[model samples]
Target: MGRRVHWAGIGPNPLRRRVDRAEAWFAMVLTVAVVACGPVLVWRSGETAYDRAAAAADWQRNRFVPVHAVLLQDTGDFIPVYGEDGKAKAAVQAEWTAPDGTRRVGPVIPPAPGTAGTTVLIWTDSAGNPGERPDSDPMGAAIGVGLLIALLLVAVHAGVLLGVRWWLDRRRMAAWQQEWKDVEPRWSGRR
Candidate 1:
């Protein structure tokens, strides 16, 4: 539990003293619950859609940079594609717009893998013309457990509020104390 902070002059505020100490214990429990379960909630071992996007993003950031490629349409601008290999290796049939307003189309040889949402692939024919790569997809694995943890944390916060409200009700607590008091009456039971 964190040390209670008091106001500069008045030790602890009067309202703070009225606040039940049990409320603090529940807050501690909620914090520890999140901290203990957080790692498991965030991570998933099996693969899913989220994992694929993460994997692709990592590969792009680490392995290569996007290339300035032209769209092969008779009248279309250019978009960027990740390069095949090192800087020296030019993209075959890789479309790019030259300084002039013309589409520079070349066969992107060897054929590259498709990306997350869309299948963007090209292969160079014998004449060095780029064509689409064969597409194949089944159920793929990914990582997306963080959402579950977020829901659990929300529930914990609700529980904390409920506990605090119960503690603040004086009558229920007073009645409970009275029952206990009658069971083990004080020495001066005249009252």
Candidate 2:
């Protein structure tokens, strides 16, 4: 038969100090709090982030329209710059006719190594002003933000636990020092 192990500072133990029991109870309560609150906080934060990201995506979809623009200059070979979409991009001067039938020319980012006179698709606002590409994955954004928040929460919980432990250790040290002050002289026959 295996022997059951008893947790320190729990149950009826004459050797258990008051600080030990307090530490044990505090740890138990903190564990319970983390278990009870962590999931709810993470879920709520993730839901809120997802809703906001989705709304912004919908708004951008409605506001931006695609237009074909012609590159006027060759996109020379250069270090590839990655965009939010993780795709390499190159900047070049381009011209396009807006929906309002007005000619517009500006710097545009297209796929790297673009040739002159090549037509590339670009996003623009309703008034034909340059605009960023709309976010396509709200769920990804939610997951990323949620994970970050969860990590922060975990860090906070760990810090609190460590801080409490440190305080308890200080109390224990002070009590030991006080007790030793009385015991040391008697034990050394200096009384």
Candidate 3:
């Protein structure tokens, strides 16, 4: 019961050139295919990203334990990594009591920038070595994957349409030039 569509067809008319017909068919098919495939591609990409994030979280949970620590001094160790919030990251020396009730000292990445004596939560391995916390934010993973898929879809759609349009435009111009070659002399009264 859907409305029937009329595809562009090649003709003898200069306005309905072969290149125009080809571009029309290609564009229609590409639009339909991209629209149908967008959701599936996005879903698959999101799933892959979620799986990796969940795996990392599971690994961290199994290997690390959270502990409260107090910064001993500002060791001033800075890494070039920036958080999603665009804040600079740094490592500072801190001391915490391990599960075995032994005082352990090492580098701790505070939730925010902190000076000496600032109390913060830190994760440590069973051997009392400092480590990263388990990432448990599902929203973060979803947003990240969604943005990536959107960008990819936009890029692909633009590239396909523009490439085809450019090619057809060039062909149409050449056809116009060839027709003019035959007509220009007669029109100018030279023949």
Candidate 4:
């Protein structure tokens, strides 16, 4: 026999049994709906993150400046004591000239471990207060990574839904078999 294609209601039902047909229809509809929504969901999520990151970067760049300072003493167990390059880092009492040309003293990070006079770059805000470095790469690659994660989550959800439906279908088929076994003997005896 030739293969038959059932487009919703156009022809003979595709599956031989009613429950199988119903399950197939449900699965098809759900797959289409989730696939259709995936792009819009990912785009909105990524755009929201990018916009928030850009605003924070703008604020940091405006409020912070880099300055050179000296280490007054050894770090003595201060946190974040190593630079990104994994070299020994130390914090100490230090002095630096601020944007307004006034000398200021505060605890600052040195380029490396030093006894008293090692120079290091530190970020400071107006009024000569120590602060963190300004942000760079406003949107960066985080948006793409975020979108990928969102799409992957959508796929996983759809797969789980289908898996549950499949399990239910197996139980239904078993119940049908037991019903047939009970009725077949009675019908054959009457004939």
Per-model clash counts, in order, read: 12, 0, 0, 0
- lDDT order, best first, reads 2, 3, 4, 1
Residue 3's lDDT in candidate 1: 38
Clashes of 3: 0
Show where candidate 2 strays beyond 4 Å: 1-5, 77-90, 103-106
lDDT of 4: 0.72
Reference-based TM-score of each model: 0.30, 0.80, 0.72, 0.67
The model with the greatest TM-score is 2
Q: Pick the candidate with the highest lDDT.
A: 2
At residue 129, give the lDDT of candidate 1.
35
User: Weakest 10 consecutive residues, lDDT, candidate 2?
Assistant: 1-10
User: Model 3 reaches what TM-score against the true structure?
Assistant: 0.72
Once model 2 is optimally superposed onto the true structure by TM-score, how far is the C-alpha of residue 137 displaced, in angstroms?
3.9
Taken over the whole model, the C-alpha lDDT of each candidate is 0.46, 0.82, 0.79, 0.72
Model 3: weakest 10-residue lDDT segment is: 1-10
lDDT of 4 by residue, 1-191 (tens): 22433644223554456666666666666667767876677777777777877888888878888888877665665655666768755567888999889999887766556666667788899878887677555467457756686769677877877787788778897988999888988989853
* Model 4: how far residue 163 lies from native, Å: 6.5
